[model samples]
Target chain A: MPTLIRAEGLTKYYRRPRRYEGAFGGLRTLITRQYDEVRAVDGVDFTVSDGELVGYLGPNGAGKSTTIKMMTGVLVPTGGLIEVDGTAPWRDREKNAMHIGVVFGQRSQLWWDLPLVDSFTLLGKMYRMSEADYRRRLDGFIDLLDLGPFLDRPVRQLSLGQRMRGDLAAAMLHEPSILYLDEPTIGLDAVARDRMRDFIAEMNRESGTTIVLTTHDLVDVEALCNRVVFIDKGRVLYDGSVVDLKATYAPHRTLVVQLASGFTAARAAELLGPEVPGDVIADEGPTLRIRFEANRISAQEIISAVTSRCPVTDLSLVEPELEDVMRTLYGNRTIAV
Target chain B: MNAGQATCSDGPLRNLPAYLQIVRGRLRIAMTYRQNALFMLAVVILQIFILRKVWTALYGEAGVVNGVALADVLVYLTIANLQSWAMQDLAVGSYLYSLVREGRIAFDILRPAGFVPQMLAHLVGGTLSMVLFATAALPLVALVGTLGPPASSAAFGYWLLSLFFAFGISMLLNLIVGLGAFWTTEIGAFGMLFTLVSQFLAGALIPLYFFPDWLRTVAELLPFQATTFTPVAMYGGQLAGSEAVQAIGIQLLWIVLLAGAVRLIWSRALHRIVVQGG
Candidate 1:
């Protein structure tokens, strides 16, 4: 596999307020101002190859944004080396910027007042696009993103989903080989979120563009990503596939069954006791919940077994969302030490 | 290769304009919001009007203080208003803060091209915007100056040197200020510090000649005077020959030193930024 990005021993630190004291220890100290060092990105090493859609996952303040910033060359790393497309990013920013696109979910790169088309045009100029080539990309992105309705609307008038699509298009307008998106699907509705995931899937399959993104929405990871990297407190807790994350954390799925009225929790457990792949949660009133290993007992076999035992009014099967899995991964660690 | 050149070389910048296009694109952005842009223009004009009023009040009481005539003050003040726009050349806050917040600077940092040259691209765009607006504001100031008494030009050559030196100083000052974003929070404190020093020492409120001799000497040595006071003083026939040369020379020397300071600060700041999280 061709390596598109490689980072070695990357680290970043920030000064946190240590005390309200002084540096000179005179009038300054009496006022009480002091700062402590915070290591945001600490010695992380990873490589992303071409056409890889890597889901960079972490809890809040897990140095995810910091790591992305350094990788994108937005912030200079205090130590180690980061080479994107075989070049030092911090050394020659404009040249570096030309090759990559960045999207920040909390912020909009789209021009707020201008129509989407006009913003794209200005960005075209920023990327130095030829008129014909710009038109070509615009046409393709417009079609793929389903941006027909809001093309002429001012970016401010766009829905969050629309704005995100616009952002993704802008990032790709320069035909950057790599894209670093920090929370691309944030604040998006389910419909829009699904659309975004679909669009990303198509892009990865088509252009072979190398993408590294950090997102809070774990479904986004399951929907689009094949690989996942989880970070917590400046360290990588897990790096592999979504399959790996699920297998490692809470390796069971939940099945809730609603019976026709009179079913005791004990009797329900007793009926399905023979097929207990794992634990049974039986305290939801008329509903009986069972937890079982998916790899051990198939969901169909358990559901069928439950239906035969009790007159099943309703039954639903759910695996743990990537969100809960991440919570478990990061929540298990303590920051005080 | 006339039109086709844009196609063959259409690399990462197909979405963005190249080199000269960045300049034009910035100029377009500046003019896009007519109300906000004009509001800034009006604020600058309003400043000129207020300064003109105060200078008139002072010169009326004293005919000419320290060989500087009343009309000279009027013209010098008006010209200073026009020149103030040049401060964009070294805008410290925008340069540094933008990179930190957006993280777009990362793309720039990893490129094969020289970093400073690329940053200069954005700097060039900003300066062009300033120059365009300042040029438009000039005729209005000139028209108002005609309503006031005329000033002498005995220090014409020295005055020119002073203006040149002021440009150098302002640019260097901006570099110093912009560097603050590397080490500090958000840049509010840095902006306050530069604004306070520039306003008092650059003679924006009062001319340097109006101050006591000892204080005037000290202010002249500082970088702030190199921005406005030295230029304004020369316009009012304040210096000539060696004095003018020193004023210009000192400003250039400061520019070099400040540029060096910013670069050193930038390297260290970048390391701190990457190694330590903010």
Candidate 2:
């Protein structure tokens, strides 16, 4: 299989100053310059194929940015191998840059003072784009991003949403095959986030533009990603389908049962205990709620068994989401990556 | 994607147009304020007119000082001021330093635009401010000024050549400083020292003739003097006949040397560009 990106035994370490708190600490450390080493990205191996949209998730300070930097060839790894579009990214940067587009949520790639069209026109020259191709891609971006109305306005004057849209267009102007977006939808309102998600999904679908996204917004992953990689403390804990993740970590499928008989909470717990090692979440008069690992047994088996033994009136199976899965996987440090 | 032209042996040349495109985009942003351009023109004229009155007084005591006539000095000031106007933040080190400080330079590394060219485009964006101001100021100063003897065509030609060379050398020097951001923790010490040497050696403060003969000889050999002295001397008609022609040749040599130095520094600097700040 042809892979768009691959990493093997990737690790990144940084030496940083450890300044003591309080005034005059700077003066005290001025002569010595005391420092400590930090390992942001530890050894890990992963790969993403062309047309793959992967969710790269991690807790804050989990070395997400470090790994990203190594992938982008912004920082040479302290150890290991990284290849993007079949090239050693750091060793041959100028060649690699031609095939990738990057957008950072906190920093804009567009010229702040220039009108959107002016920025686009200049980008055409920067990338050595053919006039016809530049025009074609430009028209596509303007239409895709709905930038016609804002084309003439200076970027500094754009609203946050408008600027992000313009920035997205600017990032795509060069027609790069792979798009690396770091927190692309950060700080956006619900409507804007949804709009951004729709635009990204459309792009990935239409062009097969391989996308690797790192975001705090779970919705960004749910809306677009079929596969996700979970990282913590600079190590990859999980790399698989999103569906499998929910089925694995978030195993406790909720069974919201509409009870027919008015049974006491103690009586329900006793009855449910014999069938499964599950918790009785609630017993409100005639209603009963039970939970069990979806991975350990089939939902159908549990439902049929419960109905056969007890007077079960109604029940519904609920699929756990990424939020619940992440809580379970990361909540306890007992399991290490 | 072109099969016949697949890689570095071919594509960098193809990519050159992208750099030019970025510069054009910045130039458009510089054009928005017609009122500001007009306003800047008026202010430059007023400042130059006031300075002329001071020069007119100093000339009363002597026809010339150090062979620089009062009228010549005013012209020199105008050119020197323009040199300042033409200044571009030439350091790649500052960007690297800020990236290290903010830890954001990592983001730039992942993109296809190389750090150096990406930043060069940013520098060109700011050039608009100074270029606009300088362009507005120069013409008006010519209209109102007490006449120095007109610059000979050779002098004017050399002056234009020096302007181009000055830009190259200045960018080269600043680029070295910018690259310094990777190793040096503080830019102030080097910045102050570099500025002092540039001011005295480049002849921005006064003509190089006023320096001791030995010092002037040393300054002439160094590339720094070419930034200001070559242009001012040529524009002020300080050099004449073959001397003027030789000066242009020297300035071109300096430009070549500085550009070569910058290319060497860029290669070394890339190895040290630590972007994923802890």
Candidate 3:
């Protein structure tokens, strides 16, 4: 796959108005013309290849949205370079818009009072989609997203899950080369989120659409994205495979060992002995839970150590939760990417 | 892949069809809100009726006030109301303002469609819908009031031309005011102030000729007068031949200038688009 989207030192600095002290502060800020320069997106660089699903993750005010805005050409960068399919997004916005589809989760691009299909019709005209292509695409999305029950209803009348499904379908209706989704799964139920993740994965797999998703939902990242790009304080902290991110930030993995009936905490700890540096999390009768850093003690060694001494009935190894990894990454310490 | 062909690769000209689609959608929405349009028409007619009574008592059988005749003034007022209905797009300004405040303007900006033209088409569609409603309801109102025809077919032609340009100028002005949301959160305040000023200057509430000499000069200096006063005056024959042509020329100039101003202000506003509410 070739690089379809690229950014080098893309920056956006906002000159926010200064507020004064007192009841008249808001009013005074209007006339004072005082502004404070805030760097919303500092120098950040990344490249996404065609058909790759990359998650852009960050804490609140971490410049994730600013970067997405610049990528989508909603905001012109104060400095540095960005190219979507070889065209600078801000420099040639209309041309760049032609090749990309964007969905801002909290906002609906669909017309509020109009029927859902009417919005699609307008989008068809906007994207210049052929009538046959439009119908075919709409039918596919309707079937896949289960949007048939309320396609004729006004968007304002749909439930949040239904609205989100509608929004996703509308965003994909244009069939652009790149899709930028800012929190596409925000505020969705488990089933809806899973369904959305499935559709997003299908979009990339079947259509080869380059997916750049910014989401707070780690499940979305874990389920859909193969690569993760972590950003904080307007900087990229990490960018690599999701497994690598978990390995680098969160080393501990849990091995839940269910021993044969009749095992105590002392007995379980003794059975594992001094060879393994695993923390015995719990010893509930026959079930034993141990957590150990994967780098220090491999799961194979721990399983071997436990099974050789104790009667093992069942065993399962749990990977470090992506949420824990994200929490650790979002903390105040900077980790070199 | 057919990505390039599938998208809006035809360049900026594509805004034309997209704008037409938006207009169609907007017109449909306007139709859905028919009751609101009818209620507004009732308010405007009531206003016209009260003003007609006031003007009648003031003229007192002589049927002329200052230099304008009563019949001409009545025609001017009715036509002004209709022109005002056609040209006004307060809903667009409010919509734009809310979009700014809510940070949903990003969607509007991200599309391949040209932003200014898209917004203009939306307003034009809604205005057209409102105009259609007013036209349909006019006959019922005509039974209560009397209005004369335009001075001549040529005058009526000029009036139509003026009216189109006037609508352009009006939409542009409202857009400019809405763009002020970038600078301040008081967009609603600005919208109200703009409506008050435009209504008076455009002579939607009272004819510009009825204003004092200094006020009329002030009103004439602004673009609002072109939206209602110019078309209405031309229709009533108060402006004819060279004057009618000049009035239209002024409207055209305002359209060009206001369009330019909107473009300039819009570019600046985009720089300050703080996606509020995150």
Regions of model 3 farther than 4 Å from truth: A257-263, A266-276, A282-288, A303-315, A333-337, B1-14, B152-154
In the range B1-278, model 1's lDDT, one tens digit per residue, is: 22434553535544333455545545655667546656777776787788888878877889887787777777767766656645534343575566655544444454434445445455666666777777776678676642232125557666666676666567656766665665654766657666766767777767777889898888867778778877666665565657767777777887787778768876776666542222
What C-alpha lDDT, on a 0 to 100 scale, does residue A62 get in candidate 2?
Answer: 78
Candidate with the larger TM-score of 1 and 2: 2
lDDT for model 3: 0.83
Which residue pairs overlap in candidate 3's backbone? none
Q: Model 1, residue A208: what's the lDDT?
A: 81
Interface RMSD of 1: 4.9
Q: Write candidate 1's Cα lDDT for A1-337 as tens digits.
A: 8898888888877765554434565665446567678888788888888889999988788899888877776677878889888987766666778778888787766655567887677566556567788888999998988888899887888878889999899888888888888898889998988888887787778888788988988788888889988887777778888988888896789998887888766678878776667688888577788888888888888888888877878888887877778768767887665
* Model 2 C-alpha lDDT versus the unseen true structure: 0.73
Q: What root-mean-square deviation over C-alphas does model 1 reach?
A: 4.9
Question: DockQ of each model against the real complex?
Answer: 0.33, 0.34, 0.49
For candidate 3, the docking band is acceptable
- Name the lDDT of candidate 1: 0.72
User: Candidate 3 at A147: error in angstroms?
Assistant: 2.6
Please provide, for model 3 over A207-235, each residue's C-alpha lDDT reduced to its tens digit, 9 standing for 90 to 100: 99999999999878888889988888788
User: Candidate 3, residues B14-60: lDDT per residue as tens digits?
Assistant: 55767888888888998888888788888778877877787778788
Error of 2 at B149 (Å): 4.3
